[model samples]
Target chain A: MIEVKELVKSYGVTGVLRGLNLTAPNGQVLVLLGPNGAGKTTLLRILATLTKSDSGTATIHGMDVAKNGELVRQSIGVVMHSPMLYGDMTVSENLAFFARMFGLPSPDRRIAELLQRVEMDRRADIRVRLLSHGQQKRVALARAMLHSPRTLLLDEPESGLDQRARCILEGIINEFRSADRSVIMTTHQIELGLQVADSVAALERGRVALHEPASAIDIAQLQARFSEPTEALGAL
Target chain B: MAEFHSERGSGDQTETAPTSEQQDSGSPGVFVASLGVIWAIARKDLLLELRNRDVIVSIAGFVLLVFAIFTFAIDIQQADNAELVGPGVLWAGIAFAGVIGLNRAFSLEMERDTLEGLMLTPISRDLIFLGKALGNLMFLAISIAIALPVFAVLFNLVVFRLELLAIAVLLVIGFSSVGTLFAAMSVRVRAREIMLPLLFLPVVAPLLLASIEATADLVAGDSWSEMSQWLQLAIGFDIVFVIVSAVIFQFILED
Candidate 1:
């Protein structure tokens, strides 16, 4: 459901995504693994229609990202490291606001369902700033799913979560898979990413260094390959 | 690994595809939906303002400070002239102090960078601008409400009367329409606090002059028809600036 072709994006003289291409089929998750400054977030931003690529084109569900951004926006749900919610507003308020933004029908029921799905129904009235990081992530998750978007885009979702929180996060990711929805997530968590991805791609220097079915490569080999020098990997 | 281009129906553009804006404009309910989104967003902003009370408190304190300082600075000997100049000083203080509140209005969104999050929604960017502008207008209304009584007693100015209050509201809306637009633009700049007034003041000079003239007329009990041109100028700027700023807002709101 997500597509990119020979995309080149840059900031001034610095190139972030240089002649890159990627595709993730619907009904599975594609986790982008890369080190810091590897343009993972840049790639996701382009797909999210938040940033326009310098050249080439990216489309979500076969519509040009730059030209059809509004449709792309409606189809995709995004969760970044930040909760992207008002700290002062209650959990229910955040969801209600977003529900209204999406013009969802019967928002009260939808908000209730989302809060319950994220296991945040109990704290619905509590202010978001008062919630713990894990709790905030839970609320954030509920906010992202409120619109029932066809595609999910997550950036560094597990950045600060503990093992238990990671498990919860993984469960949310797994839920998307079971529903046959497309998910594109960018994270540095190796084991967790591999566990959820139907296909995995590793980015190096803004180019896909490795792309394959998750079942084709074990975590041990992936780790060892990742540790090797850049020169060892031949031309793409 | 080879670059992962799709094997099925990737490059071929969808035949039925229409831009989301086109879809929205084509829809009959688009106007109502946009209005709903605008009001919903504005309500969110108002809720945040009520919770923090930070912007309101700052504006109130600064407005009072302006009044108190003006009271002490104006010699009792020049009481008549001070009363004559009161309307201008009152607006000057409110405009300057209110812009501070406007500058901090989006600070909540700046914390988690939620503006970009709003951009990801299907709502048009102009609606977000209107929502925020309305929220700021509310803040200005609150400050002016408090200042009206205090401004009268402190400076011996006759500003609380109905006609003058109407003029105040019109001028406030005019100031806020452009003020809110520039505040959003300035908040993103590095030197934002300094940038806001520098960008805001010059554009608002005509409205300020009209406000002073109209308020002067009301204070002097001059014929309403005599102040018609000033009222027309104020209303004209209010309508034109609001539409222009609403349209221009979309261009500035980008990731």
Candidate 2:
């Protein structure tokens, strides 16, 4: 679903991604577990075609993300911070706009189905600004799914959600895999990430320090590896 | 149906999935669909403005207050020669209000971080520029409508003439063309509010001078045919600036 190699991205002297390579195949969720400033967001942005890498090759399926950005955009769904939704528009209005943009057929029916799936049908008419943070987050989730994207890239989906909201997020991720869609997500939560992810990896110092199946690794060891800084980071 | 298709170092066969973009782009009604995206973006902005009433109301209030103050402070109303002063005061007030409106064009996107969402749509940046510039132009036009009667009464001048309307449209279109581009650039920097006017003054110096002079001529009873050169200059700049700004805007908005 996603393939990246030698992705070196930097901001002036401060490097964010250094020779990072990772992959997430179809029908699975890949969770990137990392500490603060681990370049997880930058990696996702590259895959989402929201930002360019300084050097390296990253492709979704086979299309180069930088060269075929328009095609890549048409295939993937993205969830970033703060919902990325207009506060003044109603939830339904927001979905309808994207639906039209995606050239979705039968948009009203699709909007209804997504809203019902997210348990947000009751509040579809309410303005986004009036909703609580969790509700707005749910709307954001629905908006991302409105186009039925094949690859889902979410950056920190569990940041401020309540337990119920987190469960909905996990359910959505699971549903993606069940439908043969691939998922790439970044989070610091070990237990929650492992529960939903089929594969797990840790990014440190702009490099992938570890990549393994979630079922193979011991949780405690995984936590320890993620928490400590690597002395080999500078050398790499 | 939406699986990824990649090209590796060597020839390799992978599961081929068709791209919907080719289908959509090749369809018979693509032009209409493109227009739909443009109108959707512009409509969202206008609706947001209508709901908040921030930019238009504040701009109108500020411009009207400036006009009234200039009328009293400069005594343009009592001048034995109001024409000489009226155009200067009018353009200054309009220019100030226009800048404030333009500055909000991209700051609102930055405020909500909705820019990334727009980018992900893969809509052409040229269309984004057109939609935003149109929205800015509409807001300025609304402000002008609200301020005109009050401006005329305060300065004791006739702002209802056809030539005045023509000059106003040309000025607003020219300002919006350049202002939208600068506003997009300035919002990415710190101190965007101060940055907006500073970037604006130098770029629009010639346009503003022509605008003020032309307004002075019309107010001084010069016929449109007589001031054809000034009108032609404004029209020419409007064409060149708008096209140039639209072309250059995509570079400024790069991720």
Candidate 3:
């Protein structure tokens, strides 16, 4: 479980997250929806321990992120805007490096399994620089899933994924949910995000404008919420 | 949607494979774990260099170019000033070439945002610094090893002495120790090429001075006692740089 309270963050004079509160329980997919500069990536960065909040508390499995960063890192996998991969390294090599870092007992076996699952086993020897954007995204996903992190924090994970990789991604998220793990992903793909989300939360002006079960909101309503003016959702 | 197979395939799951809980239950000692992380990072760097040959090639080229230019400009055949200018030329060549290696030490990580990937690992930040520093030291040592003979032939000087080799090692150590730290700090800057030297050169100046003095004394056929003071200063600088840089590396890496 991941819980955040009163999270406030800023850059220079610009505020990104302002006393924001959120909770993501285990065994569910919480899709975060927002426009540009809406603090989605900033929020993920804080949760991933890449960026510290100016003031607030974020905990994963009751371990404070600020105080227990390494512990929190061990429990979470992050896929940011960039693939976060070494372009010069082959797919298998990249996974092996991360596996060793994670101190996995059987890296070769785990790497082979992940490569096959991600449908990149055939291209295991190909360098990341040689792969297409979608292919690289697949490898990035494979890298993220290497350590079997309990929480997967994906930011714009579907940006370059083709239809087949999207299916693979959906399958992976479903698998995580089935295993009672938590997935907190941010995306602009309304249909795909809603399709796999157990719940949806919309962010406006560094605050949660709306939070509800996925069943309570459809594509049209979510689109309307996003397209409508920010002032209209002030009371939300 | 096609079903993605389970992570644990029938033949893929092994008893040797440890879960997170199992890993915690039978974890190695902290020292061993740190060594493992450091080795993993360094090996990755070595492999990347082997594949592309960019960093080593650039460093080797730069060092050789410096040596060639210095030999012509100094006109070492004059024989009277060989000892005086030889040590300066050698150290300058190495100092500048070392910067080339140091610049790539972290910029490679920045190119594809792999540094953040590294930061996400469970390993401590100091281990990352040590690993990169170790890799940089090895690259500099290798480049210098190759360049020394070339330098000797060009300058008509003997650089194969034990004392000189030891001084070279110290130079490499001191350069990489602080170089890696500043490299990480300046990697994100837009003009990192300019920023690295601006941040690194001044700090390493004293160590360079000691190394040059020791090398000059050694080349001039002076007794050990004559150069002993300079060697001590170099050694002291290396020790302090490595410790202070390693301790504060975490801050340089943090946002």
Candidate 4:
């Protein structure tokens, strides 16, 4: 399980997350919907331990993120806007590097399995720079799943993916849910998010504007809410 | 099949996870594991360097340029200045060229945002520092290895000696330890190229001085024992900075 309470973050004088509160139960997908600068990425960064919240509490599996960062990191995986990969390295080499860092047993077997799942096994020897954006994104997803983390935090993961890659991503997220793991993803693709989300929350002005089961959210109304006039962009 | 994979993948993955006992007990298992992580990082760096030759090429090119410029500027061939100033020039040149290598260390991480990927791993920050510093030290040492012959030819001095090798190791250690830390700290700054030197050079000034003195003594045919004071200074600098840099690296990498 993942829990966040009274989360606040700021860059300089601008506030990004202002006392936001959220909870993601295990065995489900919670999709965060927010306009640009709504702190979606910032929220994921904080949860991933890539960045710290100015003031708040975030815990994964009952361990406080701030206090048990390394332990929390062991259980959580993250994919950001960029692929977060070395372009010069081959796909398999990239996976092997992370697998070694995570200290995974039988890393070669694990790498091969992940590459097959992501449909990149054929291009395993090709440098990442030679791959298309969608291909790179798929490899990034493979990298995140290398350690078999209990929670996956994906920030705009679908940005450059094609239809086929989108299907693979959905399959991966659904797999996470089926295993009783937690997946917290932020996306601008409302339809795609709603399709896979068990729960949905809309973020506005650094707080949860709306939270409900995915079945309960009215997509048209939710879209209208975010489209309405904004005071200004939040700090990104 | 998906269910099986997910279930198998879930949980602690304790095969590699460091237990509190392993950490506190300082077991051989933990020690070996730490070395493995350090090697993984260093190997990744080595692989990248081999593919692009960016860091090595830049360091080598810079060292050659420094020697060439100093060779002409000092005009040491006309007088006995080669024996007197050659050691100082060699150390100074290596020091400045090293900054180029250090600057690229973290900047490459910033380029594709892979640093965040590394940060997400469970390993401690000190290990990461060691791995990167080790890679940087190797590059510096290699450049110096190549430059020594050139230095000997340009300055007309015998640069090959066991004492010089010992001093070189100390110099590289001191350079890399502090260089890696400052490089990560300044990576995000707008003027990082300028910022790295400003941050690194002043800190390594004493190490540079000790190194130059020791090298000069070696060039003067003094025995290694006679340069003990300068060697001690260099060794002390390496130890202190390596410990301090490794300990504080976590903060430098923190958001």
Full candidate order by lDDT, most accurate first: 4, 3, 2, 1
- Pitting candidate 2 against candidate 4, the one with the higher DockQ is 4
User: Which sections of candidate 1 miss by over 4 Å?
Assistant: A218-221, A224-236, B1-28, B76-79
Using lDDT as the yardstick, the better of models 2 and 4 is 4
Best by DockQ: 4
TM-score of chain A of each: 0.92, 0.94, 0.95, 0.95
lDDT of 3 by residue, B105-165 (tens): 6778888989899888766677788889888888888888888889888888877898998
Q: Per-residue lDDT for A52-105 in model 2, tens only? A: 899999999787998887677777888887788888889998888766655564
With candidate 3 superimposed using the best TM-score fit, by how many Å does residue B219's alpha carbon deviate from the native? Answer: 0.3
Best by lDDT: 4
Residue-wise C-alpha lDDT for candidate 4, range A1-236, written one tens digit per residue: 88999999999999999999999999999999988889899999899888889999999999888888788888888899889889899999898898777777667877788888889999999999999988999999988888888899999898888778888899999988988898999988788889999999999989999999999988779878997333211211
For model 3 the local lDDT of residue B4 reads 24
Of the native A-B interface contacts, what share survives in model 3? 0.48
Tens digits of per-residue lDDT, candidate 4, B1-255, equal 342264336445554745333466788889888888888888898889999888888888898899899888897977679988898889998988899988986788789989888888887777888889988988888889988899899888987888889999999999989999999989999999999999999999999999999988888889878899999999999999999999899888878
- Candidate 4, CAPRI quality class derived from DockQ: medium
**C-alpha RMSD over true interface residues, each candidate:** 9.6, 9.0, 5.8, 2.7
User: Which predicted model would earn the best TM-score?
Assistant: 4
lDDT tens digits, residues A163-201, model 3?
789899999999889978889999887677788999988
What's every prediction's RMSD, in angstroms? 6.1, 5.9, 4.7, 3.1
Clashing pairs in 1: none
